[model samples]
Target: MSMINTEVSDFSVQAYVDDTFKEITKAQLLGKWNVFFFYPADFTFVCPTELEDLQDHYEQLKEIGCEIYAISCDTEYVHKAWHDHSEAIAKVTYPMIGDPTHQLARAFQVLIEADGVAERGTFIIDPDGKIVSYEVSSGSVGRNAEELLRKVEACQFVRKHGSEVCPANWKPGSKTLRPGIDLVGKL
Candidate 1:
């Protein structure tokens, strides 16, 4: 089933952040934009690069009032270890959530039960806790954080201006199309 437009399920999990461990919950995500980034595991190929890429854009995402949460099936201890060892991961300021029981991965529908890992899943959730956009990709394929930021901008734009819609490759300050009878079949 499609997860788009669905409210995030109730969950409370431990997360490693800023050299300490803290608890995070669905309720905490309410009233702010959030990015739930799910990866397979820690200490693997391709994951660090993707995480660093996200770190590069973390400030921009925060400027737009979005908090990023990087999740994996690994435990919080593992997350901290990776952060300590990996320079790429060490630069990350966002929360790294530990889903040891796979509850989060299962809720996001990215769990690989056989392998006990999660697929690459990125979910953009609105302040109301409803998922507005999501992308699920294979484990081997890495995602671009810049593109995710663009989509968030578009989603925010459409939310504020209900009548207009962003077109393909739409960026901030770009023209948006408004659906109307006169514009039908014109494009």
Candidate 2:
């Protein structure tokens, strides 16, 4: 089994922050809500559009105390080059993590062994380093940043108000179901 609920496992990786590189690990991301987005190789199709969308929403995400990290098998150098050259990448302000060792991908169960790339995987890890939400998509499908925002809101709400669970298509200020016998079979 994978370590979904465990603290950032014993893995270290480097990330490209605009023009420079920085070493990062699970420990460094602790005490914050982490959105670990795993994509395919850099300079590929579909990935840039999705990344740009996330970039556009970075400030909104930050307002909710969430940190975004885009990861791929490419090295930090490659990430920097792509960011420097691609117009779609210019908007991204978050770190582009380099998972050349595939340890992070493997831990998340998104690594494609034959192609040496990761599927589209997004994991929402809470401050405790336990994964709260996870989504994996095929290469052809992109992600929705708006939906992710809603999820973040839901997670934050649940964390603050224990014993309440968000129902389907739940939004902020929406009613949450409390677990009890009286609420059984009311759906």
Candidate 3:
């Protein structure tokens, strides 16, 4: 049970965006590339660094028609507090969702019950609300925003060129193999 390559239509969670609160769901994300980055909680170790890393690349992601969301099992008030306190988090202008009820975490299947926190789950959802990529790591580990950008590029490439597939570390203008029986084991 990992929720990979599945259509996520239930985006029934409230998100904090630019000092306001709004309900964000899959419907709002139609015809848009969505990046859902989950962390354990706010005001803790490792999470701030990762958020800052994402902050460093937020403009690039926005330019590529992708919306990035950082989520945790904390309240919007808590998110606001942390954002106000931490300089790194202060630079994060993207939507930082507060999944206190764990609805979104449950939908993504990354909720850790014992600690009431979410695992380090990253999801890349396409325009059609179908997940094209997902990565789940341990709670203590952080993620790389650079890799996420590369994956988005690959996903966008495949969407444009439906007959082609991106290979490992595939950057833009790199070689992509077309799906066919002849290509199997030929690499």
* Candidate 1 ranges beyond 4 A from true positions: 185-187
TM for candidate 2 is: 0.93
- How many clashing residue pairs appear in each of the predictions shown? 0, 0, 0
lDDT by residue for model 2 over 86-183, one digit each (tens)? 99997788999999889898888899999999999999889988888888999999999989989988988889988899999999888788889438
Which candidate should be chosen as best, given TM-score against the real structure? 1
TM-scores, all models, native as reference: 0.97, 0.93, 0.94
Query: lDDT per residue, candidate 3, 53-101, as tens digits?
Result: 9989889999999999999999888999999899999999999999999
lDDT of 3: 0.90
Q: Predict model 2's lDDT versus the native.
A: 0.89
The regions of model 3 sitting more than 4 angstroms off are 181-187
Model 3, residue 83: distance off in Å is 0.4
What lDDT score is found at residue 67 in candidate 2?
A: 94
What tens-digit string does per-residue lDDT give for candidate 1 at 13-62?
A: 99999999999999999999999999999999899999999999999999
